[model samples]
Target: MRKRGKYIIDKRMKFKRGYQRKMILKIKNDNNLTWKNLADEFDVSIQTVMNDWGREFATIPYSLGIRMIDKYLSKEKNLILSYWISEILPKKWGQFLAGELNKKKIKIPQESEGLAELIAVILGDGHLERKTLTMTGNFFEREHHKYIETLVNELFGLSAYNIKLKGSNALQTKFHSTELIDFLIKNGLVLGNKITNKARIPEWIFSKREFMLAALRGLFDTDGGIYNKQKGYKRALIEFQTHSPFIRDNTIKLLQRTGFTPSKSASNNSSIGCTLACNTRIQNQKEIHKFFNVVGSANPKNILRYKYFLKRGEIPLKDKIYKEICRIKIIRPFKRL
Candidate 1:
C-alpha cells in the first residue's frame, strides 16, 4: 500500500497537500515575494490566482476578496493555489500546467507575462511552430485573448532584422529565449540577472548561454542607450574600456576590423563614442538627444543604442564627441591618462 501524509501524490484526489508543501517551499525561498513569487513558484500566472474563484472554495466576503487575497493571503496565495490546483483541480489539470512550465521560452511562467512573451516571440518569428505547447488548446482555454498577433506587432515590432537577430542555426534552436532554454536544457535557465563581486547585469535575463553571449556581443555592436548606473548597474553588463590598462596595446587590436588598424586617432574616436557628457548635459533636454548626430540613425535602431549605453549615462555631443575622435580615432599611446 502506498503511504500517505497530509499531502497525497497520485492520479486521484490530486496530491494537494504535497503540492502545497512543494509550492510553499518555493515561496519561502523567493526573495522578492512579488507576484513573480507565485509565477516562478507554481509556474502559473499571478492573474490566475487573483481570478481564482474564492466563493467556490476559500469562502470570504465579496468586498474582502481582493484585500484578503492581495494583502492577507498574498504570501499564502502561492501555497493556497498550489493546493487548490494540485488537490482541488483535476489531477490532469495539474499535470497540464506543470507541463506548460516545461515548454521552452515560457517567459516568466506566469499566465500573462509568459504568454505575452511567448506570443511576442511566436508572431515575431522568435519561436518555432510546435505541437508540444500550443496557443490553441491548453493556453487559449485559459487566456481569453482575441488573437496572439496584436500583442506581437504592438510590442516587439517584429521585422526581418528582429527575426534574424533572434533566429538560430542550431539544429533545434528556436528564436525566442524561452523555448531555446527549455529545449536545450532539462531544468536549466539563463538567470535573468546575476550579481557578483565584480559586476551585475540588468534584469534577470534567463535564456540560453549561447544567447546570453550573443546578447553581450550584440550590445557591443548596437546601441540601446542602456546605462549600467541607470539600472544601478544591477540590470546591465557593465564594461568601462577606458579603465583597462590595455586601452590600446591589447584591446584596440582586438576591436579592429579586417584590414583596419588601431591608431591614436581611432582610439580617440572610440573614446568619444563611449562618452556620456554628464558635465554638459543641459537640464530638461531628454538624454536621447545625444544620438542625433550618429551617421546612420536607422541602422541599429534607438533601442539597441539604449540597451548598449543604458543606465550608463548621457552621451557627449559636439566638442566632446570631437575630442574622443582625436583619442581613439586610431593613433595613440594616449601620451597621457
Candidate 2:
C-alpha cells in the first residue's frame, strides 16, 4: 500500500466492481471482446474475470489493474505510471483525456559564452530543481538578476520570470525549462540536490578566454563585493566569497591569469568558506581596474563603486614614461626625480 497524504492507497486490493467497470469501458473502447480473451491478454485468471462481472470479488491487486490499463492504452511497458483515470469521463471530455498523453518536444540550446556565464551565476547563487533553474539575490542587486534574464532569452530563446518576495529584500528569478536542466547536466552541471552534489566549472571553458571571462564575471557579480571604508584611515578593497573550494580556487587562478595578485583567507569560525581579497591600495587599483577591463561587474552596487573609484582617481592608468623614468633613476643613483 502506498500512502498518499492523509489517504492510504491499498495497492494489494482495490474495489473489484469499480476497477472492472473502468477496465470494461477501456476494453470496449479498444474493441477487445470476451472476458476469457481479455483475461488471457492481461494474464489474469478467468475466475477473476467472472468475479468482476458478478461483482463477487471485494478488491483487485494494484499490479494487475495497472497492467490491464497499460495494455489497453498501449502505453510503454517501462513507464511506471503513478496515476490512472479510474473515474469515468463524459463522452465530450474523452478527447481532452486522450490529448493529455501527448509528449512535448523541447529544443535544447547549443552551448555558448552567454550560456556559460549563466551557468556560472547559477553555480554561485542559484539552485536547480527537477523542472527549473532559480537564481536569487537581494532586491538591491537587481542588475545581476536582469543580466541573467537577458542571458536566458538570448541563449535558450526563453522568457524567464522575476518575482519580489513579500516582506523580504531577496528577489527570485526562475526559468521553467526541463530541457534547460538537461542541457546544464550535459554541459557538466550537477542536477538535483546541489549542496551534497555540487558541480564544478566545465574544464572546456578554460580554453576559451571570452567564455572564461564572461563566466568569471557572472560568478564575481553574484558572489563578490567591493569595499570602501570612509573612516579614520580610509581603505578600498574587493573580495569574492564562496563556500565551494572549487569555485574559490578557480576564481583565484582566473585572477592570476589576468595579472592580479589576491590573498586568500578562511572565514570566521562560524562560517564554512573562504574569501579572496585584494586589500592594499596598489593591489586593489591594479586588480579592480583589470577586472573592470576584462571581467567587469553586473551588480549595480559594485558597478557604482567601480565608477566612483575611477572618478576619484583611485584607480589610475599606468603611465609607461613615468614608470620607465623611475626605472632608469633606480638603475643610477646620479639620476633624480
Candidate 3:
C-alpha cells in the first residue's frame, strides 16, 4: 500500500521503539561504554549519534534516522535505494568517495566521510538541514568547519561572514555575482553548465548562497537591471554575509519613503536586460522569464521585460530628489574574512 505524503515505511519499522529507546538511555548512562561502540551498534553516522546524544526525543529505532530518513522518506527516494547506494556493492560509488582519486575530471564525490556534509550544503537545496549526526558526532566543529573555512575562502574570496547578504540569493542584492561564479569555478568545488538555444543565456549552476546568507545584512536596492524571465537564472547571485540584514529592509523602507513604489511586473529583455548584465537575479523573475520566452516572438509580455532592463545607467538629477535616496551606502570590496 502507498503511504501518505512522502513517508511510508515497512509497517514492521514500528516493531521496536520503546525497547530501543530504553537501551539507548541505558547506553548513555553507562560510563564505560563509548559513543563509538554505541554508534557501531546502531549503524548510523557518528554525527547522528551525537545529535541524539543527551537529548530525549521521540521513538528510538535501530539507527538514528537523522541522516537517512528525512532524505529517503522525502520525495527524492527510498531506503530500498540503499541496496545500490552503499559502501559494499558491486558498483561501489563509495570507493570513489574514499578520497585521493588519481583520475580525470578532478572528480568530486556525492558523499564522503570528509566531504559528505559539505557536498550536501553546496549542491543541496541550499536550505538548512538538521542532522543530529553532524552535531553530536563532534566532527562538524572540528573537521567540517575547517573544510567550510577553506571552501568559502577559496571559492568565493569571501568568508562565511561575507558571502551572505541581506537577500537570500546574490542577484537579490547589490553584490557582483559573475565574480563569485568565477571564484567558485576557479576553486573547483561546484559545476556550472552552459545552456544553449536559450535566448543568449550562458552557464547555469545550482545555488549555495541561500544557505550561507546571514539574517541581517541584506541587499536593499539592486543597482543593475532586474530579471523577469527566470527569477533566479541570473548568472551572478547576490548574497549576504553576517552584516545586519536590516540594510536592505531599511533601503526598502527608504525607497518607500522617497515615493518609489517598488513596482514589480513582467517586462521583456529590453526592460530586464538580455545581456550578461542581468544574468543572475534580484528576483522580479516573472519579467526575466517572460523576456526570454518572447526573445524573438511577438509576445507582448516578453518584449516588455526585455526592454525594461536595457536602459542607460545614467541617473538624471531631479529637483525633488533627496539625499538619502541618492546616498551610496558603505559597500566594501568583499574579502574572505
Q: Quantify all predictions' global Cα lDDT against the true fold.
A: 0.27, 0.57, 0.27
Say which prediction, candidate 1 or candidate 3, comes out ahead on TM-score. 1
Best by TM-score: 2
lDDT: worst 10-residue window of model 1: 189-198
Q: Which RMSD values do the candidates have, in order?
A: 17.6, 19.5, 21.4
Q: What is the per-residue lDDT of model 2 for residues 106-158, given as tens digits with 9 covering 90 to 100?
A: 45666567766777888878876434576778776665677677777777767
Best by lDDT: 2
TM-score of 3: 0.21
Candidate 2 differs from the real structure by a C-alpha RMSD in angstroms, to one decimal, of: 19.5
Task: List candidate 1 segments past 4 Å from native.
Answer: 1-87, 90-179, 184-217, 220-337
lDDT digits (tens) for residues 13-75 of candidate 3? 221324333444455554355656655555533323432332322223323333333432344
Of candidates 2 and 1, the better by TM-score? 2
Query: Candidate 2: which pairs clash?
Result: none
